[model samples]
Target: MTETQTTAEAVTTTRPTLLEARDLHVEFSSRGRRARAVDGVNLAIGEGEIVALVGESGCGKTTLARTLLGLERPTSGEVRYDGNPLTYTSKALKTYRRQVQLVLQDPTGSLNPRHTVYEAVAEGPRIHGLPDEQDLVSKALSHAGLRPPDRFFLRYPHELSGGQRQRVVIAGALALNPKVLIADEPVASLDASVRGEILALLLRLRDELGLSALVVTHDLGLAWNIADRVAVMYLGRIVESGPVEQVLTAPRHPYTQALMSVLPESPERVVLTGEPPDPTRIPGGCRFHARCQVLASGKAAEAGVHTRCRTEPLPILPATPEAQAACYYAETTTP
Candidate 1:
């Protein structure tokens, strides 16, 4: 296979971290109550690594992504690029934004209906006041697989297919020569056939450009398809994280295990009794204990498991050198 060929086993490695979030917390207030979207979250993305942040809808993944990009200020904690805290000054922020690009979930909404593909892709360079705008736009379009770049230059968004539109959006991001890309549900809006193509294009971009990415989605299959590592978020926190294979195959946290159990190919099916607990009123002690089967079935209480499960929240601790989970019984429970 060629070096850029993507297969079942995707390439991934941990070099120095390029972007990181330390104890990040983002909260919003509504009617006198504060909602903790991202609560004390810590994450790191090594150069060239694809880390998939997976969870159900409203699990704070998108909020965390925005914080990492410096789009939203955290209630507390900090975001760092190349080990340095992000700067908030206008010039600094402009430079930082160029290095960290965001690919929105909806390509149609992201691209203006009135703008041609060339105009859309050229906007970044124009904003940055860069010369050689045409070269940058053409190269970005080509890199994003909009081959014969000239062919699509004059086409408007409505004239393109979903996959083509997404590629155009990606091309626009590439126009800035970004070091990292934060894609939110990149394939959720594409057809099944087109989804594979877009994913392949992303993998190719990583292999060819040495770009790092944080893919936020609920699809475990997508993680398996391209990501080297996976982080499972729940109720504003990372409940489990590790190499994709280890986390998907032998998940430690009950929440992680339950998620994996429901896959069409999973050997066991874990069906929790109720919907996820309200984020504004997240349960005390173990956040998941309210619906955790081990505790609910009386097994944990009978075995006299860690009493902390009934009195204090558990912090995510390492299960292996490369993995971590945030459950009191993560190491002992079968899930």
Candidate 2:
């Protein structure tokens, strides 16, 4: 077998589950209409596994991440940690957050301009009432690549470069010494050169600390670089998921294929047509049927699954460890 295949197979695991979502759902009510930001979905992050959640904006990836982080309460269903269902009590949630920290999209906005580097990194430990704030802060900063940690003790958000600001945000989460990091677009704001640095830090942390992560991003390139497994979201559900290399290189779902086709410098590009329907008025059957290239090109009909694709929902089926897709046509034909 080739080196790439060997590497891909290495990540296909049945490790003990660390975090899980069982039929998770989250909804928002507005102007007499309800938006299902996160519809019925199930996902798991194995201990020491790095799973990337990929999707376009407004596709509920963020809502899913927030719900998993205990920041958003689901309308129904449950989020579980180590076999226990999530509880909404303030004390319980607070303790949960200490183990699963979030690194937001924007570093500048996430950090207060008034706070110094030391103060920013120290905040998490303080909030959790953890002891040895100074030591935790110093170690977190160093771990995040801000070495000679004392040198940055007095620097403000504006004083550091964009990459440094992001590192500070990461350090804050690290001070809590989280086992799981839910990083939403961690390197989105950094320049190309700096993006690599931040990504490297995340990988190192995962290897050295045995930290698992849920990296939420739209970039397939980033997922290929960092994730072991990947879940592709559409509208309010995970339509496809599996090992990253398998999904990225041989995506079976039509939506996932469209996404991969457009990766920078990819040989072919699939430009999708039309805006995603309003979340409040999500379409029936397949949420992606309306935008599906398979349906548009008559392939689903050719395969004898088109009508079913438009009138019935398909569950995400992992026929094998390498792949899964919530598409009747893809599943039937993906031998």
Best by lDDT: 2
TM-score of 1: 0.92
Clashing pairs in 2: none
lDDT of 2 by residue, 244-324 (tens): 988898888989999999877778888889988899998878889999998999989999999988887665332124577
lDDT of 1 by residue, 1-335 (tens): 22112122211335777888777789998668888898777778988989999998888999999899888999887788987889788888999989999998799999999999999999999999999999999999999999999999999999999999999999999999999999999999999999999999999999999999999999998998989889999988888988999889888877887888878999888888887777778777887887788777776667676476777767643212277687767656544
Which whole-number lDDT from 0 to 100 does residue 175 have in model 1? 98
RMSD of each: 7.0, 5.6
Per model, how many backbone clashes are there?
A: 0, 0
- List residue ranges in candidate 2 displaced over 4 A: 1-13, 316-322
lDDT (0-100) at residue 180 of candidate 2? Answer: 94
Error of 1 at 21 (Å): 0.4
